[model samples]
Target chain A: MYVESTGIQVIETIEELQKTLNRNERKDTTVGFVPTMGFLHEGHLSLVSHAKEQNDIVVMSIFVNPAQFGPGEDFESYPRDREKDLRLASEAGVDIVFIPSVEEMYPADGGIRILPGRQADELCGASRPGHFDGVLKVVLKLFNIVDPDRSYFGMKDAQQLAIIETFVRDFNLRTAIVRVPIVREEDGLAKSSRNVNLTAIERSEAPAIYQALQSGVEMFADGANPEAVERQVAEGIIANSSGKIDYVKILAYPELGPVTDDTEEIILACAVKFSSTRLIDNIIMSTKDGTPCSE
Target chain B: MYVESTGIQVIETIEELQKTLNRNERKDTTVGFVPTMGFLHEGHLSLVSHAKEQNDIVVMSIFVNPAQFGPGEDFESYPRDREKDLRLASEAGVDIVFIPSVEEMYPADGGIRILPGRQADELCGASRPGHFDGVLKVVLKLFNIVDPDRSYFGMKDAQQLAIIETFVRDFNLRTAIVRVPIVREEDGLAKSSRNVNLTAIERSEAPAIYQALQSGVEMFADGANPEAVERQVAEGIIANSSGKIDYVKILAYPELGPVTDDTEEIILACAVKFSSTRLIDNIIMSTKDGTPCSE
Candidate 1:
């Protein structure tokens, strides 16, 4: 499958991809899928690398999924540079890159969509009406298309990861979900394709988003009340980054519930806007002993 | 996996079943899954036979899914006979019978569920609320758990089959759905596990249900208006059986949309109740030239 030293299969049609994967499947090749919305960054490459390490072949998708975008969102303006993405994917040793068009992916005006259950409404889903649903639909479609042995996602988007975990568990998807640790820049900003959209001034200030989340985690560990931590985090983001805060909440980790004193693991999550650019960051807090708490 | 002459592997947990299947998966064995409720009859056996013919190994599940049953819709009274089912599955050459308890299948109370749009609102779904949602949930779960190359289903539950087909197609499930043609009693009543609930008198009158459907199809084929065909089907059922009609609707096949002039394939479906016994039957009609007309 990887005969080319620098060349990788660039599959555009779903039928061709399925046929190729079916051939590999008959030979009992284990597949790992990494779904991306184009404009590949180090974060995406890390996922691809993880996939290659774990499975026999890695299939990466780079369609700027239209379904996940809402009205007035960056669907049309989302970053795209296919040549750069292809270069990165080849360097990461990807087996295939599936690139489908808007028409090919979403032909029907209104087709099947996955409804995000209880977990979707709190963070990103609260602002973007049907964002999580769209994400679920596309990912589910990709999972079916690739039928991967394992699928990789970053812990950076904790809520999205949690939702996918639930989707796979509840639906009994045998494709095991492998959650990769979040990759961050030296300045501590979580790596994202959207980070490319940040202006020079905004890029420098965006690191404060992660910095604020870290402060909240530290406060919680220092025995501060959940409310106090929430307040400090919100004020820190507004003060340091000069970004409008969307939400700053202290909640139970992985389970995504309200924070109580006895809550073993907690997620300090928030979203902020800087000069019209929206960014999100979070950190998971657990007891110093690092015991497994809420999964 | 079979260790005895009548020794079909009986797995009680999803994890154990997955482990066994994973071993076979690594060996490149083609797995076919047949999901069912207990009290296995010839109809269920037929599905098993179909799976056996197409796959290297067959796995059948017998769990009377409670979620698919509406309140007061015979969930509690649903029949079960483990010993008998085991014997039947063994005789049918089933390789494995997964009999999971409700707790094992649905681990959490407030968990994820599917929201079936469009087609779910008609036919049997019209009479039973959340019926298709429950069916989709369980079937999706079973698909995930088995991760089979193919899943066999009887066309007897036409609406259920149609909905599952749509679910698999839309969700991008790779498990090919093999629709086994409807199995029926010699007297023409479609064989169902529910037939056990019928009293002697009701059982004697049940064949008329299928007979009335035949009359409706004959009338429609003879160029009766859609409304007239509906009337004839309803009247024929009431006259021939002592059962109260739940619904008698002639609709487009597969999509389950309302019947119209341009409808290409037709599904003449009905549900009737005698005392507490309910029975459903349907006939699919299409043009001889294979033009898309009614379904």
Candidate 2:
């Protein structure tokens, strides 16, 4: 899969990636990074676009990290297609695509992992124990290796983006984190690689996850209490969709803490399992002052 | 007592230090870092000299990290003399000295920490649980903020140095770890800030700790059984000193694992309690192949 003239360098080893990044670093070129667990979708491509526009060189890493996956969590069957990813990433203006095998990222024994503090105890963390901490460890590793001036993450995974942002602040890492808005299908379904696993009918029902989030966002914007917003979303997903509801939560934006009188910019989010495919979506709305309104 | 005209920059925050470093980084200057707990002594000064010799710029941080201290350990009473440290650091050719408050290094609530792998289970770890992991967390934080080309650590804490080197390799940090030889007092006691806390009798008896280490090194050089070597060192320290011995371990150099027939270099390490103060020291001697003889 040769890209005509994109100059996309697809390297598979950490040493080669460091050499590539170092060369750009020596020339005083600012590098931007987009990290992904592959199977390219529009959501990831949007982050790639943001990265390319922000820096002189853009690097995208495609590794289905094993640490983030639990024992029964589809690690063995996670979808991977390097040929398609290569062509799409090249066309998306990624200067370097780092595709490392899991063995390269983690040794036979799992290396050291992060014990994420209080922030990881709520919402999604309850359902998937050690998930976000696993994510933080790998992202921290990538940030150290890539040494990017800026790194992009799609807000499609609001919890993930929030946790990683906290990790950066807590560690005082040099890279700047840029949060991009989620990209959705015309039917309002958020783009996800897991969507491919859904049956046609289940896929049709997946839009309800976003619809529930949208409903909660509207209710919150109308000055409804957080409890009411959460109830409305939860009931809406369970009642209107054929998919099994996982969770519908309403909370403070990046902090993911409880919403109170002091809270501003609430995030209403939900997840649904449609024919064994679990998907999540969220919407952020202002409550009072927009402290971080850059997005 | 300031140096006549040495341009030593003492930064108190991560932001200011980063800004200072970025300017030098842009000029392609190689940065060497030495991280220390305050009350600068010959041991820490040795690390700083090695750092200065290896790079265009030398950065030393004097942070009496509270995390590395377990409850009942010396976090509150850790000796600190900033004025003396400043003069000594400036004399050592340090370009920058970063002294961050615990609040600045660790946010209001101490944030994410690393869960160190197997190597953290033995040695000092058995005496002070979660000690090396705490050291790892702070060092990882320092490496991120410093962004140095090479970092220096004294071999006095052989276990700590080994674990940090493993961390650098495991996480693929850009900084190269350079181990400096342990600096000893004229009486042959390993120099440590904790030495100041000892009573006159304890101070006088401290030389026996190093004497035991030297004895162990001599035994290993003669290819003595590692178990017999450990016994000799423990009994020597106990019989020769008024201090209560904590541990005497002769293990594979950097791995800190059990010694085997193929072991290349051996670390003869000990920790002893002199009244209320704890002192640690070690010596590395070449084995069959001498993998750790780089120093």
Candidate 3:
């Protein structure tokens, strides 16, 4: 299914990426970028597919950033299979595979944080600590290196997506930050490269996360109070088939702030554990005032 | 003289700036950006002059970022004369003048600090509190808007320059951040728009700021102990200056970290008060064995 070599290119250095992009930068051809830490999945593909449809060129970056991972968080154990990822990206019609090494991304004495303000401090800020900082830092670096006209991201990482949105605005970034819907497994687990690490039993129980989020969505859809919606989502997760509940929150979508009263848009989101693996999922719902399902 | 029209391209929306820049984004043209508050000064002019030399187009952004200003500090009272700044920038051969209103830079709701972590949490971090957060937030927005080939900053704002340097590296930003040498008054007072607000007595005492920094540089050059050099510099300012000493530090040059005896490439920097105004400056120095003055 691969077209002749003109369709896709691979870049590992800032200079090469810039040289390639420099040619198209002057033209009206829209370039869309999808940045990933490799180990590609349908979720990333969903972004790629959307990017392919929107722009004339699609640039996918596969650099597993170490800065985003905490002290003991999955920096080493983070699943990676570049061969598989490369094939999947090629199949998805990606125009370029910008796979930079750790040294390429961060030279000795490299320092920068692409994190956004208030948005990062909330939600995942507490859990991952420097997670959003790392995400924004890398995304920004990618944006500069790729110089894309538009960049696509999966909404599964709603907080990360929100922070990027803020970063683009705050930094006056040149690229458009486009967000695609969260692609999920048939059973409702939000698709992630990390999903590959889940044990068979953990994978089976993964759908409970979607179920809990769906229950919250349903509650909000049925005119439940925002507080009550949060409670119901937590209760639903606690009653799940397997795993410990890390957090069950019904927040304002997009902003990731606490949901107050019966907001027009509420996001039913959660993080849960099946043994050592952690999974997160969410659903956006709206109210009668025509507020968005995902705020 | 007056070449291009200057209306303070008041972009209240990030989307608007994106739309405008997208239409104008070009390759091969070096875009030089100089970010500042509205008040114009020779110090800022010096930066613009440097930008004009290397760039085909120069974009000067006048934004008094509220985030950088401390509470009970003069965020509201910060000097702003758009007409004056436009005239000065236009006279200095600027191509574009970007003067975004507060709402243009920040969303009504988002409050996240753009650059966070240990780098941000040091130096001015402990003193101004959220000051660096504000500086970074605004600077990121400015960079995004300008998307310059090389951005120019004055060495007068050494820590700010350091943070921006770190920001570019961490995010993998392609924009080259260039620091211009510090411009000083003939009297040795560091050129700052804030210098205008100083009382006559404070103005007379301002030269001591530079003098003390020079002494620190001389001491370090003469192979004096770094700590002793820093102490002498601080003591000199406190003894002769009208302003209270905020911080008199000899930091490792470029890194903006603390200096030890073995530190090389050091910067003797300080901020002191004169009545209601605060003035800051630094002199770059190197220790033996090539370590920054601060280690």
Candidate lDDT values, in order: 0.82, 0.82, 0.75
Q: Which predicted model would earn the best DockQ?
A: 2
Cα lDDT tens digits, model 1, A1-295, are 2334567988887777888888334466788999888898888989998999998999999899877889998888788998888888999999898888877666553244568777777888788888988888888878878778899988878888888998887777768999887788999998888888888888988888878877777777878887898899998888887789888877776667787657677777888887756888888767554332221
Model 2 agreement with the true structure over A233-286: per-residue lDDT tens digits: 888888877877677787787778888888777777777766666788878777
Model 1 bad stretches (over 4 Å): A1-5, A23-29, A107-111, A288-295, B1-5, B23-28, B288-295
By the DockQ metric, which is better: model 1 or model 3? 3
For candidate 3, the chain B TM-score comes to 0.89
DockQ values per model? 0.41, 0.55, 0.44
Any runs in candidate 2 off by more than 4 Å, and if so which?
A: A1-6, A23-25, A107-110, A289-295, B1-5, B23-25, B108-110, B221-224, B289-295
Which of the two candidates, 2 or 3, achieves a greater DockQ against the reference? 2
In angstroms, the error of model 1 at A113 is: 3.5
* Candidate number with the higher TM-score (2 or 3): 2
* Candidate 2 local distance difference test against the native: 0.82
| Residues A63-133 of candidate 3: C-alpha lDDT, one tens digit per residue | 98998999988799888897788888888999889888999888755344444566655556777888887
Cα lDDT for residue B162, candidate 2 = 83
For candidate 3, lDDT tens digit of each residue in B58-150? 888888888788888878877788778878888888777777677766656455555445555445666787787678777776776766778
Model 2, B1-295: lDDT tens digits are 1223567888898988888888335477889999999799988888888887778899999999888899999898889999899889998888889999988998844256787777777789889998987898789889989888999988888888888887788778889999888888998898899999999988988999888878787777877888898899989988988888788888887878888877777788889998879999888877864333523
